[model samples]
Target: MSERVTPSAEAARALRDIERRRGQARAADQESRWVGVVFGVAIFAELAAPDFFGDGVRSWIGLAVAVLGCVYVVMLRTPRGGALLGRPTRLRKDELSPRFVWLARLAILAVMLIGPFGLRFLPQAPFPYTRTVVGAVLGATLIIFGRTLQRALTSLALRRDDKDGLGGATYGSR
Candidate 1:
């Protein structure tokens, strides 16, 4: 004879599964903190290259950074790459609010534009360290803000899942 499961038991099982999946997702998000650090260091290296390297070497460094960036982007599109990077290969529209997305983009753009331009107007320091200073600041900002933004996005995604009655179990299923 086979045992029959009650509806309540099935629902309880689903809830537990959903919670487990959410926990996993959160862990992955935390693990992705390294992504920001890596990117920040790359930015710092790219900008500070001129300070420490000759023209020929700086160009090679720039090329290397560009190639690595391209590789990272291409990898982001693949399942294995996404898993390796601790990021989702695809994000559902409901997981991110368009307004917030736009705001974030605009803020980043403003910072990018303002930083160098603002630095240009400042009196020359004893050493020609403008690029180095800018690079360090921008790199640090990226590392700090990237983690905060990721957390906020994760929270938004989780809230959306709860609101949609999915409980995060259906995340990335589509």
Candidate 2:
């Protein structure tokens, strides 16, 4: 029989397939990051309530948009690890918390609880107080988010640690 060029002989075709898969994975990762960023921006936007268009409700509109954006993005990216029965992606618990993150977060929150009161008596009047309150709320929100993620990541990291004895240490990989 005459020698024929099988699919394996086509480097371009193989490369195309690999590229397509890579693109898909990248898209999924991007979707996940977008969900996080959009949600964060939404919370802050709603809280800030900027005077855009002089309409007090525009910030709420931005918040609504952010919610929709997050929902759409989440629909696109399948979760990496969960109770689902599939060809095992990331293990259910393969994450860890950074050093002193929890403590620093707590300290920020403690100061915030005390800062608003301190700001009111400042020589500059309500300006510093207003900014301090807003900053504190935003910082508190961020800390809460970080803690929740840390718990999830820690569970995953512990699982990996116990499985492979990998020493279970990571720094802000999330």
Candidate 3:
């Protein structure tokens, strides 16, 4: 006779809870990723628009788009949400530490505070080149931060999956 093992009721309940939490975490991760993309787009728009965040029509449009993105980001918050301006998810043990969350917020705040001043101080280069320069800087920053956000989410999800004895590796987790 072959021996078989079945989960206890308590174990089954815990597994269900883990599955629910994982699903929520996955949703939160996706939402967080979208927020990062929107943030990047907003930064790019603010920097790459014709007059560099002025009162012109293009600037107004850019601001409107950014504001809408911000609204969407805020709407993503769940009952377990954490780090309003940064992580955009519940706390995780292996990833998104509180210190890291604060650091991410500070870094973003620094960019927000310093970017415009840095641009103003820069020597006014030729038009096309100036646009290219701003685009490159902001675009690069966006890509970097987007990747970082994605990695954090992926790490958190993978760690949770591991803790819960979830069978599959997700998002190329090692």
Query: Which candidate has the top score in lDDT?
Result: 1
TM-score, candidate 3, is: 0.49
Model 3, span 54-80: residue lDDT tens: 437575866687687666655545333
Q: What is the C-alpha RMSD of each candidate to the true structure, in Å?
A: 4.4, 11.8, 8.2
Model 3 off-target regions past 4 Å?
1-28, 31-46, 51-55, 78-95, 126-129, 136-149, 153-174
- Give the C-alpha miss distance for residue 103 in model 2, angstroms: 13
Q: What lDDT does model 1 reach?
A: 0.72
lDDT of 2 at 93: 24
Question: TM-score for each prediction?
Answer: 0.64, 0.30, 0.49
Model 3 CA lDDT for position 136: 66
The weakest ten consecutive residues by lDDT in model 1 span 165-174
| Global lDDT of model 2 | 0.47
Q: Which residue pairs show collisions in model 3?
A: none
In order, candidate lDDTs are 0.72, 0.47, 0.58
lDDT of 2 at 68: 78
Task: Rank by TM-score, highest first.
Answer: 1, 3, 2
Model 2: per-residue Cα lDDT at residue 103: 61
**In model 3, how many backbone clashes occur?**
0
Maximum-TM-score candidate: 1
